[model samples]
Target chain A: MKEDYKIERVKERINYIEDVLASVAAGDIDARINSEVEDDLSGIEAAIDLLIDDLTDELKQRKKMQKEVEEKLAKIQEQQKTIFQQQSDLLELSSPVSKVWDNVLILPVIGTLDSQRTQIMMENLLEKIVETGCTISILDITGVPTVDTQVANHLLKTVTAARLLGTECIISGISPAIAQTIVHLGIDLSSINTKATLQDAMIYAMKQNQLSENVKLHSLFADSDENEE
Target chain B: MLQLTTDSNWTELGKYIIKTEHDIVQVRQLIRVHAKEMNMGIIDQTRVTTAVSELLRNMYNYGGGGEVLVETGVVDDKNALIITCADEGSGIEDLDLAMSDGYTSGMGMGYGLPGAKRLVDRFEIKSEKNIGTTVRVMKWR
Candidate 1:
């Protein structure tokens, strides 16, 4: 009778261990089989060992999936950052012209001009001159070091666009080397106002401003004195 | 319209393509100066050199030796720059695994090709088993 009782207990323990394994396979790592050896329950322990082996396989698969998902998310984030940088460069390249002084708008080109940036620059310069009602615009390139044929074409586009808006664009700060390069390339800036330096461009703008102001002031004083007479 | 032209600036990098970690600094400095002299923006310059570093790292680690052809200046009414990198190492066996993130044939954090593509406007690649690999990267101003 005792032998039969022990066998029944062993069977019950084996069932409990099976339940634990099911939970573990369903992704519950905390599940543990609580089976005690009551009068030689070797069968129950052997079954428990089998369960542990299966659980190990399940855990590894889950970990692999997690790692793959994480890697994918990281790559996506890196691509987003790149797209953001390009957009930012695009926005900055577009001129944010505020005011026109003495019928002249000065657009300072700084930083490098990639193809996209160059396209945006040409569009911005043309738009600003028309919007601001300026007849003359000076492109100061002191910050610009050199130009390739492609970049030179963009600059030419800027000049042409400005002319379409009935504004003449002045390109200033032609470093001696750049001037020689332009000459060697056989591209002419003769249609555009070329200045030796930014200082020259600024001086020219100031002179235009003063001359216009003097005329306006003179007319104002003449009208007042005539009224007094 | 895109036009093609040769730039003397290409002469400065010499014959050796960036092939190792030790070479990264020189590659970066040259890229920075070339980009700066070309008037490439601060941010583009940063992305570009960082990308170049990653590419050169792969070349050095895998190929052990290689050459890079760098073209700076504008192309076709656009400020254009192109860098072509090639290496004669034991070529990639499983390109599928190679391109996949985290599936590096070498070590940890395999994010080379993906990162390079992200940094520039255009990126292209050609590779073969037992031959070598070549990557062309371009960024316009």
Candidate 2:
């Protein structure tokens, strides 16, 4: 009778372990086999609890690493955004559009020409023309290093836009390299007035502006003479 | 290991370590000078220089920076300009897919390989899995 009671106690402990394992399998990480009952089952319970601890630690570590990587990526993205902003600002400052002469706007472009900077340049030029109502504009590319097909297209567009606003645009400072690139790209610059240097374009603009002024003066004098007569 | 196709009498025009955007610019300028010396004409100089720019950028962007060697040599008894870029980065898994136009693994226009090919007179690429990649291009004078 005493041996039978001992066997029954062992079975009860086995059933307890089975129940705890089931709970753990059902996603209860907190479930643990009671190891106080010193028996063969106690050793199994200790091993299982140790396994759960290791798995929990590993999962926590992975989560921490994931968060750290995500934070670093976000920081990199923010830095990139700031750098781009600074680049565009530099482009804007480099390609300053201003009314350097009375009734004449001048935009001196330096550095390499890309699509983005060209777009910015066009916008800035158009804005100045509208703001100052200048009838003559000069685009000086003396400092520009290279001009690709897209950049040439942007220049054409800028000239066209200026013409729509009743402004005559003159392009100057075509370096040999740029001239070669334009020819290789087969761009048609025949309609646009081009000069070898900014000084040349400025001289042309001055001559045109002064001729119109002289014409206006002559008309005004003629009107006064007619009134007197 | 890289094998040279030409004899050892090649004149080293320039060598560049491409790591950043500024380095790419330097490479382009260097090639332009060399191309000018070879009398490749202004248009061809621009084309080859642009090709170098694209290739160097690919090495920096995809290969995490690499070494580029520019040499002037004789090919088929004619003056030739040879450019080679080698990198110890993850090798391309699918070279065909990478060479195809508009096949981009990252945020790029996917014109590096094929565009460079189009700009040069001859192009070749050698890559091994986990070993690295090397690109060679030649332009005749």
Candidate 3:
């Protein structure tokens, strides 16, 4: 009778071990066999519990590592976005379209001419022209390093586009090298006005502005005199 | 005779409709972004973007408006940015004259076509009178 009772006890313990293992396999890492009495099966129960503990620890470490990696990736992406925004901001700051005179807008272009920068400069100048109703714009390129055929072509296009908007664009501060490059490339700037320096362009713009005003004033006087007659 | 060819492997990146002056600016911005993403140097970026600007201006001025397709492909085992511009305006009667420098039928400086050709690696233009015109340009990285 005692032998049968012990067998039944062992059988119950084995069934509990099977249930705990099945729970662990189903992703319940907290399941454990709490075997208290010391016996032959006790050693196996202790080993299985230790193994589950190690597996749970390992899984926790893996999750932490994954979270850390994801955070670093997100930080890198944010930095990249910031860098891009700063670059565009620099481009905008590099080209400042300002009204230097009553009817003159000056765009002082410094550094090397690239298509992107030039396009921005052109757009800004055009928008300013429309906003201020300016008739004369001086594109000062004194600080420009070089002017290839492409750069010269871009300048010409800008001037032409401005003319279409009823604004006369003057190419000022043209270095001798740029002049030579333009001529060598067979580009004709005959139709467009050119000035040796920004000072000269400014002087010309003011004079032109004064002349147009004088013409309007004279026409007004003429009309008044005719009305009096 | 200008032969029009098609490549099956070119992947389209973006498309822009050229109608207003603001559209031109937007297209230039898009080209710059794509060129930068492809790791093109600033000078090459400028050249390609400038060439596209010239083509866009031509379309806006003469063609009344058009569409530009930006694509990427492999040419001669090198990565290439391919731009295709199509216009529904009346086509040029003489392609040779139009391609010549300083031979503009309009008010441009006559440097649009030839200058654009000089700025790219490969340039192909096809036109049919009263039908339309298509210009395809490729720049290799």
Candidate 4:
């Protein structure tokens, strides 16, 4: 009968659809198609295939994008590293801040505190004190961000290293959070002098500063060379 | 969703760290741009940036020095991100000890891994003796 033939065709299409889904589940994305075979149910199968194709394309795009991103990121990170190095080098080359009175040295650290900058600060502070023949160093960190255990440690390290150099280091302008963090971390900074402000540290430094007679080569670099010429 | 898989080659030795200093503003700006390009939502962006900053600090400090990688994706209908940090110098001998808070290897305060791990939904760390180390972070939308 004509009705029996139509039902058989519909059943055949359904079987085809089931096979398509199995293929998709197996990760064979290219196995489906949008063919019109004049069956009563092929249309629905076609629609599902189209949808799967769309999702597949989108996934591909995303993967490509992720790959591109990884490449660009690697490049940027590389560039930034060079930048960090150059900055530290520059900091090393520059003069460490100094106090004219008592020949004390002051280094004002502003902005956020990280271990690297702290390390650089310590190095610069020591080198400058040594270069200037100062016995006192003042670190003014009023403009720094809140402290954490790491940052506090760097500060302590700076003080300890300075002491090894036979120099007295003063830390001034401790914010509330910083003080709290130090206490929370239980780091003992008892050895370093503390001041409420830079002005205070400077005043303290002036009183303690005494130049060695050996360092009094008044014209150490002799601009007098030009004068003689 | 983000997944962490071990890979040794990610650590780039012989590469220098170009520090811009506390140029926090500049560093933050670059991170934001990266987040947007990855199609991250505002909250996720903030978290990723913070985690990245923490990792960056580590690389800047104990990394002996190397590069960082951040990858974003979608899995199971969830938007996800994976941030990876690599270091090529002498890797940490005791990862668990290093990850412990306040257990700094140097005179440093040592919050790099712990702080970075805290910022993400999932965290994994892998390091080989004298080879390199990689810290992977994952978060979902």
Best by DockQ: 2
Over 4 Å off, model 1: A1-19, A38-94, A98-101, A114-124, A176-191, A203-229, B1-30, B33-141
lDDT of 3 by residue, B1-141 (tens): 223676898899998899976687678779978988899977677678777877887888788889999999998798999999989889888999999988889755787788778778999999998877889989998
Task: List TM-score (chain A only) for every prediction.
Answer: 0.58, 0.70, 0.64, 0.53
lDDT of 3 by residue, A87-107 (tens): 789889998999988989999
Among all windows of ten consecutive residues in candidate 3 chain A, which has the lowest summed lDDT?
Answer: A177-186
Measured with C-alpha atoms, the lDDT of residue A166 in candidate 4 is 91
Model 1 Cα shift for residue A159 (angstroms): 0.5
Sort the predicted structures by DockQ, highest score first: 2, 4, 3, 1
Give the alpha carbon lDDT tens digit for every residue of B14-78 in model 1. Answer: 33556444465566568767777778866667556656655676787788767766776555567
Ranking by TM-score: 2, 3, 1, 4
Report the lDDT of model 4 for residue A133. 79
For each candidate, report its DockQ versus the true two-chain complex.
0.04, 0.11, 0.06, 0.09
Q: In model 3, what lDDT does residue B51 have? A: 78
What digit string (tens of lDDT, one per residue) describes model 4 on residues A1-229? 9999988977777787788788977888777856577554667777888888897898789989999999999999999999978867865544247655656787887765565566777777787878887888888888864454455667888889998999988999986545544543355667779987889988887766433533444455365666888
Tens-digit lDDT string for candidate 1 (A1-229): 9999977976787687778878877867777765555445656566676667677777889899999999999999999999989767756745555454668888888755545566677777777777778877888877764443334656877788888888767889877655654554345568777899877877787787788789999999999999999
Q: Which runs in model 3 stand beyond 4 Å of their true positions?
A: A1-138, A141-229, B1-3
